[model samples]
Target: MLIGEVARRSGVSARMLRHYDSLGLVRPTGRTEAGYREYSREDIRRIFHIESLRSLGLSLREVGQALDNPEFAPSELVDDLVERTRERIAGETELLARLRRIGAVGPADWEDVLRIVALLQALGSESVGQRQRAALSSVEDVPVPVEALVEAALNETDPNVAGALRWALARTGDGGLALLAEGLGSPAAEVRKRAVESIARIPNGAATALLQESLTDPDVPVRRSAALALGARGVADAVPTLVEMVVEGTNDVDAADALTVLARDSALAEQIATRLVACLADGTMESSARRRLTQALAEIPGNTASHALADLSHDDDRAVALTATYIAKLRNAQ
Candidate 1:
C-alpha cells in the first residue's frame, strides 16, 4: 500500500505517516519505481500500533520507545498513563464545576464572569485571609453561587474562614441546604460536623428540618452540633441530645443554655426537668455529670424543676448538694 492508501485505510493521515517516517518511528518497507514511499503489510501494522498507543495518551517519543525498546515494561507505562488520565479527568471535572458555578451566578458580562472566577479562586486559595475575604465579599460584592459557599464551608479547616463561609451561606437562605444535607452523609466525621454547623447557622425552616434529621447522626460532634442548633431554634426534639451533652460533658454549657431556651414553654420546662431529674437519679452518672445536669435543671422554671432542685439541694453527693443548694437559694430569692 502507498502512503495515501495507508492513510485512507489506517485513518493515519499521509502527512502524519511521513512525519512518523522522518522520526524513524515507522518507515515504509519499500519504494515504487517513481521513488514514492510504499508501505508493506508489516509497516501498516506498525502504523496501527502507533495510533493505538497515541489513543492512550502516549507521546510520539514514548510511542516509539514502546514499539522499539524490547526492554521496556508496558506495565509501568500503563500505570503512568492511568495516573495521567486520572489527573486530566480531575482537572476537567474541576473546570466543569467552576463553569457551572459561574453560570449559576448569571454573570451579565465578561467583567462579571471574571469577577466571579477571581472570587471562586480566592475561595480555594491557600491563604486563609484570602479565603475569608472571599467568603465575606461573596454576599456583599456579587452574590456567589451558594453551592460554592457550601463546598467551601464543608472543606474549610480554618475556624475564622469556616465561620465566614457559614455566615455567607446563612444569607443565601435555603439554597445550600440540600447540598449541606448531602454532606451530612459524608464518611468523614469532620465533613459531617461542618455540614451540621453550616446548617445550624441558617435560620430557616429547611435548615431546622435538616438539623432535626441530623440529630441521629452517628458522629457525636455532628449530633451535638445539630442538637445545639435545634435547641436554639426552639425545636423540642433536641431535648434528648441536649440531655446527653450534659451527661457527657461535651459542650454541656451551650447545651444547657439551649435547653433553657427550649424550656421557656411551660410544658417543655416540665418535660426537661423530668428528664434532668431522671439523669440525676441514675447512679451510673458521674458526680460531674450529675453536677452539669443539676446546673441545666436549675435554669428550667416550673413546679417540676423547682421541686427537683429542692430535692437535689439535700442530695448525698456534697458537690451536687452544695451546687444545688446554692441554686435553690438563688431560686428562693427570685
Candidate 2:
C-alpha cells in the first residue's frame, strides 16, 4: 500500500506516517519505479502496532522501544500507565466538580464567575485564615453555592473554620438541609457528627425536623447532639435522650440544663419528674448516675420531684443522701 492508501485504511494520517518514517519508527519496505514510498504488509502491521501502543498513552519513543526492544518489560510500564491514567482521571473529576459548582452559582458575568472561582479556591486553601474568610464572605456579594459550603463543613477540621462554614450554610436557607441529612447516614463517625453539628446551627423547621429524625441515630454522639438541639427548641421528644445523657454522664450538665428548660411547662415537668424518679429507683443505677439524676430532679418544681428528692435525702449512699438533702433544702427555700 502507498502512503495515501495506508492513511485511508489505518486512520493514521500521511503526515504522521512520514514523521514515523523520519524517526525510523516505521520505514517503507520498498519504493516504486517513480521513487514513491511503498509499504509492505509487515510494515502496515508495524503501523497498527505503533497506533495501538500510542492509544495506551505511550510516547513515540516508548512505542518504538516497545516494538523493537526484545528485553523491554511491559509490567512496570503498564503499572506506570495505570497510575498516570488514575491521576488524570482524578484531575478531570476535580475540574468537573469545580465547573459544576460554578454553574450552580448562576454567575451573571465573567466577574461573577471569577469571584466564585476565587472563593471556591479559598475555601479549600491550606491557610486557615483564607478558608475562614471565604466562608464568611460566602453569604456576601455573590453567594457561594450551598453545596460547596456543606462540603467544606463536612470535611473541615478547624473549629473556627467549621463554625464559619456552618454559619454560611445556615444563611443559604434550607437548601443544604437535604445534603446535610445525607451526611447523617455516612459510614464515617466524624462526618456524621459534623453533619449533626451543622444541622443544629441551621435555624429552620426543616433543619429541626431532620434533627428530630436524627434522635434515634445509632451513633451516640449524633443522638446526643440532636437531643440537645431539639431540647433547646422545646421539642418534648428529646426528653428521653436527655434523660439518657444524664444517666450515661455524657454532657450530663447540658442535658440536665435542657431538662430544666423543658420542665418549665407544667405537663412536661410532671412527666420529666416521673422519669427522673424512676431512674432513681432503679437498683442498678450507679452512684454517680444517681447523683446526677438527683441534681437534675432538683430543677423540677412539681410534687413528684420534691417527693423523690425527700425520699432520696435519706438513701443508703451517703453522697446521694447528702446531694439530695442539699437539693431538697434549696427547693424548700424556693
Candidate 3:
C-alpha cells in the first residue's frame, strides 16, 4: 500500500504517517518507480501497533521505545500510565464539580463568575487564613453555592476554618443539609463529626430532624454531637446519649448543660431527673461517673431532682456526696 492508502485504511493521517517515518517509527518497506514511499504489509501492521499504543496514552517517544526495545519492560510503564490516567480523571472530575457549582449559582456575568471562582479558590487554599476568610465571607459576600460550602466544611481540618464553614453553611439555611447529611455517612470519622457539627449550627426544623436521626449514628462522636445539638433544641430524644456522655466524661460538661436545657420543661424535667437517678443507682457505674451524674441532676429542678439529690447527698462516694449536698443546700436556700 502507498502512503495515502495506508493512511486511509489505518486511520492514521498521511502527515502523521510521514512524521512517524521521519522519526524512524515506521519506515516504508519499499519504493515505487516514481520514488514515492510504499508500505509492505508488515509496515502497515506496525502503524496499527503504534496507533494502539497511543490509545493507551503512550507518548510518541514511549511508543517508539515500546515497539523497538526488546528488553523494555512494560509493567512499570503500564502502571505509570494507569496512575497518570487516574490523576487526569481526578482533575477532570474536580473541574466538572467546580463548573456545576458555578452554574448552580446562576452567575449574572463574568464578574459574578470570577467572584465565585475566587471564593472557591480561597476555600481550598493551602493557607488556613485564606480558607477561614473564604468560609466566613462566602455567604455574605457572593452567595457561594451551598454545596461548595458543605464540601469545604466536611473536609476542613483546622478548627477555626471548620467552624467558619459551619457558620457559613448554617447561614445558607437548610440548603446544605442534604449534602451534610451525606457526610454523616462518610467512612471518615472526622467527616461524619464535621457533618453533625455543621448541622448542629443550623437552627431549623429540618436540621433538628436530621440531628434526631443522627442520634443513633454508629460513630460515637457523631452520636454525641447530634445529642448535644438536640439537647440544645430541647429535644428529649437526646437524653440517653447525654446521660451516656456524662457517664463517659466525654464533653460531660456540655452534655450536662444540654440536659439542663432540655429539663426546662416541667414534665420533661421530672423524666430527666428520673433517668439520671436511675443511672446513679446502677451498680456497675464508677465513682467518677456517679459524681458526674449527681452533678447533672443538681441542675434539674422539682421534687424528683430534689429527692434524688437528697438521696445522693449521703452516698458512699465522698465527692458525689459533697457535690449533691452542696447543691441541695443551694436549692433549699433559694
Off by over 4 Å in 2: 72-76
Q: Please, what is the whole-model Cα lDDT of each candidate in the order they appear?
A: 0.91, 0.93, 0.92
Q: Give one digit per residue, the lDDT tens place, for model 2 in 221-258.
A: 98999999988888999999999999999999999999
lDDT of 1 by residue, 1-334 (tens): 8889898999888889899999999998999999999999899889989989999999999999999999999999999999999999999999999999999889889988989999999999999999999999946567698889999999999999999999999888888999999998899999999999998887888888889998888888888898999999899999999999999999899999999999999899999999999989898889999999989987899998888888888899999999999998998899
Model 1 CA deviation exceeding 4 Å by range: 138-140
Write down the TM-score for model 3: 0.95
Q: Considering TM-score, which of the candidate structures 1 and 2 is the better prediction for this target? A: 1
Candidate 1, residue 217: Cα displacement in angstroms equals 0.9
TM-score of each: 0.96, 0.91, 0.95
- In model 2, the clashing pairs are none
* Root-mean-square deviation of every model: 1.4, 2.2, 1.6
Q: Which ten residues in a row have the lowest lDDT in candidate 2?
A: 138-147
Distance from true location, Cα of 54 in model 1, Å: 0.9
**Per model, how many backbone clashes are there?**
0, 0, 0
